[model samples]
Target: MKKLGITLLVATLFVSCSLSKVEKSARKTVDGNWQLNSVTYDEKGVFNTHLLNDVTATCFENSQWFFRSNNSTGTYNILDSDCSTGVRNFRWAANEIGKDSGVFDFTLKFTDDKKKDIEKNTGYRMNLKYLDDNHMQITQTIQFEGKPFNINMNFTRTTL
Candidate 1:
């Protein structure tokens, strides 16, 4: 009876530790779904931006990101930051109406939103900050019609 009880306790502890590690790894932005929390957009160490309050959530499955944001929802083929893949591809409906789909490729890029907005903009850059499993900050440099613009978008997980 004593030996059986001890064995059960040991197995329980092992499982608990393993779960904790997995949870930590999942919280990382590169691995799983992360929601934007807050951002402060700046250029040359100064702030000059215009953006509405927005939130975004991204999920990685089968090497693609099922991305959803304010006024946009689509599937994005994402490339990792390691550059193992050349670029990410995505197809989204045009204008959120008429149910038309278009394709775009984001090359030399990184982020959970890469493939979503790849075309037209030549130099789009972003960085993601993970606050927890449910919170993140996404900073974006949006070039409008080949002009420079800055934006900071925040999002929180719906589950959270």
Candidate 2:
């Protein structure tokens, strides 16, 4: 009976230790190339899906975002089908203001020849959600035309 008790305790301890290790290693990093897969828009509490079918979605169809782990800098390539191709240089930082909060702050500036001389700068504070090895979603709320709009963009990892 004594041997059986000792063996059971050892087994439990082993299992617990392995689980903790797995949990720690399962955290995913945002370093890699990610492609924009889809987006959803919420207006006045109404949710609209299948936003990629619209004509404006063509501008973002071939969009790609590359994030670097070393310096937290990235580039967004906008390969618009109908419009001119452009690239935006951005610096991103993850913010954990709360215990369970995961937010991303991005500052974007045009790097193309035409807009390179322009002083227009865009920034966004978005919440990072459902981030895993292959998939991630970002949500942002903005005011457009005197109305509140919530946009959710989904991405898929394209590089290792």
Candidate 3:
């Protein structure tokens, strides 16, 4: 009984330590500028596409999402080919929705120049996954034409 109790305690400690390490790594890995590289969608089937394949993606071309670690504030710079360039300031955070779960609840809130909420009660929330130090993926599900559509966006770290 003593050996079993000791083993359980060691296992619990190991798991707790591991989770904290992952949380810290996630916070660091997402702090930087990320440029959209590719996009994929699944409605009826998987469709591999690029940023220029669709109107929405095209507008996102040359766009950069900046995530700051200091104040958890960032900016989304949109450089549309046929539209004027604009910047949207926002607050971002890496959060977990459930206890001891590895799932990441990435959230963003767009704010105006005065730091007032522009989105009011709505904000962007998505599942964030880090592929590596310089690559990350964001997944979002939306209802389009009364059907559910899953969109996956892949981004690579940019130096600018």
Best of the candidates, lDDT: 3
Sequence-dependent TM-score of model 1: 0.28
Model 1 poorest 10 in a row by lDDT = 94-103
Best by TM-score: 3
Return the candidate ranking by lDDT, descending: 3, 2, 1
Worst 10 residues of 2 by lDDT: 19-28
Cα lDDT, model 1, residue 35: 37
**What residue pairs clash in candidate 2, if any at all?**
none
What tens digits encode model 2's per-residue C-alpha lDDT throughout 21-59? 222322236678999887767655554332322234446
Overall local distance difference test of candidate 3: 0.73
Candidate 3, superposed: residue stretches over 4 Å from native: 1-21, 44-55, 145-147
Candidate 2 whole-model C-alpha lDDT, 0 to 1: 0.60
Instruction: Judge candidate 1 against the unseen true structure and give its global Cα lDDT, from 0 to 1.
Output: 0.38
lDDT of 3 by residue, 1-160 (tens): 9999999999999887553655667877888889977666755564533322224665665678888876778887777758556787888777765765767887778788666777688787777865578888887766667987767778899998
Q: What is the C-alpha RMSD of each candidate to the true structure, in Å?
A: 16.7, 12.2, 8.1
Q: Relative to the true structure, how large is the alpha-carbon lDDT of every model?
A: 0.38, 0.60, 0.73
TM-score of each: 0.28, 0.60, 0.72
